[model samples]
Target: MIHEIAPHVLDNQFKIQDPKPNDYCLVYNGSKSLLKKEGNGYALPTVAEIQKLGFEDFEGHYLLNIDERAFFLLAVAEDYAAPEGYEFTGNRAFRPMAPVERLGGATAAHIAHWEALNKFCGKCGNVTIRGEKERSIICPKCGNVVYPRISPVVIIAVRNGDKLLMAHNIDNPNPMLFLISGFVEVGESLEQAAHREVMEEAGVKIKNLKYFGSQPWPFSDSLIAGWTAELDGDDTIHMQAEELSEALWVKREDIPPYATDVSISCCLIENFRTGFTLPET
Candidate 1:
C-alpha cells in the first residue's frame, strides 16, 4: 500500500545527473532519515536546505523521479545531526508523512542502507566507488559490483469458506494480528514460498493459490508478493512456536479491526473482510 502514491508517479530509471533546485534531497544516517517537521507532518528537504548543510564530497545517487522531479539520496555520517526545526526519523516510522513523501523516503532509505553496507567491497576488502552509469558500487581492484538487495517475501491469506487465517508473529513487538508471511528461500517460486510459509507457520496445507498484488516494502528492502489461497485438508492449526505465537481461523463477519492503508498484508486482509473479489489472473 505504500507504493500506491496516486496522482504522483514514481520513476526509478537510473540517471546520472546533478541535483536541481526543485529536486528533493533525502539525507540518511544509517537506517534513519532526516525529515523536516511541517505543520503537522514531515517532509523531505529541498536542494537549498541541503546546500545550507555544507556537506561536500558526499555520495549521492539518483533514487527516483516523483511527479517529473528528481529525488536524490545522500548517505551522511552516523553522527550527522539535523539542523533547527528538523528531526531524524527511522524509515519504519514514516506513516505520519504524506503518501508521496513516505514513498520517496522509503526508497531513499533503501538505497542509503545499501550504500552504507557496501562502502567496502566484500570480495577484496577495498573501498568501493559509486558506479557512474547505474545504482551500484564498483570495486576498483576486484571489479566486484554491488547493488541494492531486495529479498522476495510472500504474504498470504488462507481462505476456507467464509473464514480467513490470522496469526501473531512471535518476534513482532506490536500485538496487531497479521496474515501468514515469510521470506522466499533459495530455489523456490513465489507460490511455493507462500504454501511453504502457511504450512510451516500455521501447520496447514493451502491450494488454489491466486496472485493478489505486490508492494515494495523498504523496511528491510523486501518486495512483498501477496496471494490468496484455500485451506486444503485439515483446518487444525498447530502453530510453529518459533515463528508464530498464535494461529487461528476467523469468520469473515468476525474479522477484527486492522489497518489497510499501510501494507499489502493489511490490504489482503481488508479485501477478504469486505468480500472484495480479485480479478482473475
Candidate 2:
C-alpha cells in the first residue's frame, strides 16, 4: 500500500489567514528570499528586524517550515501597502525576512502567470484589469475573463512487485534518480499522461493505475497528481536520452540512501516494500 508524503506536518503546515499590515515575511524565487527596502537600497532583514517592524491589517494563508524558523506568507495585490520600489527581488536569494513575507514561491508564480497571460484579451485584444473579491482578471471591453492557471502533471511510481522503476532525468540538478512523470497533455486524461510518460521515458507499459495523492510544486507552478502503477509485463528498459539519463529497476530496499523530502518517489516505494506507510500528523 502506497502512502502520502505526510501532509499538514509541522513543516508543511497550511495556516490560512488574512493579510495584515506590518507583517513582514519571506518571499522566495526558487531558493532565494525577497528583500526589504531600506533607504535607496534593498537588503535582507534579520529575524529580529522583522519582529520589530510589526504586522497588522494583513490577511493571508501561510506555510510554515518544520523548525518554525520560517514561514511563507500570502496576500492579494491590494494588500501591499509599500511605496514605490518596494517590490520583491526577482533574482534568487533565500535571506531571512520578517515573519510577514506574503508572497510564497507558489503564490508568486501564480501572480506572475496572471500578469504574463493577461496582457491582452483573448477575444478582443483589449487590456484586462484585476477582478474584485477574486483572483481573476477581467477585460471590460470584451468581457473576457481570465483566472490563475494551474498545470496538472502526473507523477507515477512504476512498480513490478518488489522492484520499482526509477529513472534519472537529464535536466535535474541532482544526480539522483526520479519517478516517472510528465505534464498532462491536452485531450488526454491523467492516466493517459502516466502511461505515455512511462512508455516514453522507460520504454515500459504500465497498468492498474491508482491515484495516490497530490502536491503543489510551486517551483514551476505545477499541481502534481501522484499515482502508482504496475508494469504490464517484463520489457526492455530503454532510456530517452532527451529526458532521462539512465533507466533501470531498483529494489525497494536499495532506495533509502537516495530519498529526499522534495519528492514522493521514495515514499511510495518504501510503503510498498515495508507494508506500512510512514506516519504524518
Candidate 3:
C-alpha cells in the first residue's frame, strides 16, 4: 500500500547521471538512513544538502525517479557529518513517514541492501561495478552480472466456510497474526507456493486459489502476490513449530483488525473480513 502514491507516478527507467541540486539524496549507513529533519518528521534530502557536507562535487549513484524528481544514493564516509537539520535514524521510522516519502525511502533502502551484499562477484570474487545502462552489478574479472534481487512471496487468505486462517510467524516481533505466506521456491508457481505454504504452515489443504493482487514490499525485497483460497480437506492445525508460533482459524467477526492497513497482507485480510474477496467458484 505504500507504493500507492496516487497523482505521483514512479518513473523507474534507468538513467546514468549524477544527482542534480534539486534531486533527492538517499544516503544509508548500516541499519540507518540519513533523512532531512522536517519539523517533527523526516524527508529525503536534496543534493544540495549533501554538498554542504563538504563534498561540493559529490558524484552519486542514480536511483529511480518519482514523478519528475530523481533520487540518488550518496555513499558517505565513515564520519560523514549530517547537514544541519538532517539526521540519521533507523529504517523502521519509514512506516509512519508520508506515503510518497515512505516509498522512496523503502526503495532506496532495498537498493542499498542489495548493493551492500553484491560488493564482490559471486563467480570470480572480483570487486563489482555498477552498471551504467541498467540497475545491476557487474564483475569485471569473470563478467558475472547480478540484478537487484526481488524474491516472489505468496500471501494467501484461506477461507473455510465463514472462517479465515491466520498465523503468527516465529520471526515477527509484532504479535499480530497474518495470512499464510512464504517465498516461492525454485521451479515453483505462485499457485504452487500458496498451496505448499498453507499446508506447511497451517497443516490445511486448500483449493480454489484465486488471484488477488500484488504489492512491492521493499522491506524484505519481496514482491508479494495476494491470493484467496478455500480450505479443502482437513481444518486441523499441525503447526510447524519451527516457523510458526501459532496457527488457527477464526470467524469473520473474530479476525483481529490491523492497526494500519499499509501492506498487501493487510489488504488481503481486510478484503476477506469485509466480504470483498473474489467470489467462490
Give candidate 2's whole-model lDDT.
Answer: 0.60
Give the number of the best model, judged by lDDT: 1
The backbone clash count of each candidate, in order, is 0, 30, 0
| Model 3 misplacement above 4 A | 36-41, 77-90, 256-261, 279-281
**Sort by lDDT, top down from the best:** 1, 3, 2
Model 2 lDDT per residue over 183-202, tens place: 99999999899999999888
* lDDT (C-alpha, whole model) for all candidates: 0.86, 0.60, 0.84
In candidate 3, list every pair of residues with a backbone clash. none
Residue 115 CA displacement from its true place in model 1, Å: 1.1
Across 1-281, the per-residue lDDT of candidate 3 in tens digits comes to 87889888998777876567988887876556798787777877888877887768887788888878888887665477666787887666677787777888788888987887888999889899998778899998998999999999999989998999988999887788888899999999999999999888888899988998899988888999999889898789899999999899989999866643369888888887887856555
Kindly report the root-mean-square deviation of model 2 from the true structure over all alpha carbons: 7.8
TM-score of each: 0.90, 0.65, 0.89
Listed per candidate, the RMSD to the true structure in angstroms reads: 2.3, 7.8, 2.5
Model 1 lDDT per residue over 90-118, tens place: 77657657787788878878888888889
Number of the top-ranking candidate, with TM-score as the measure: 1
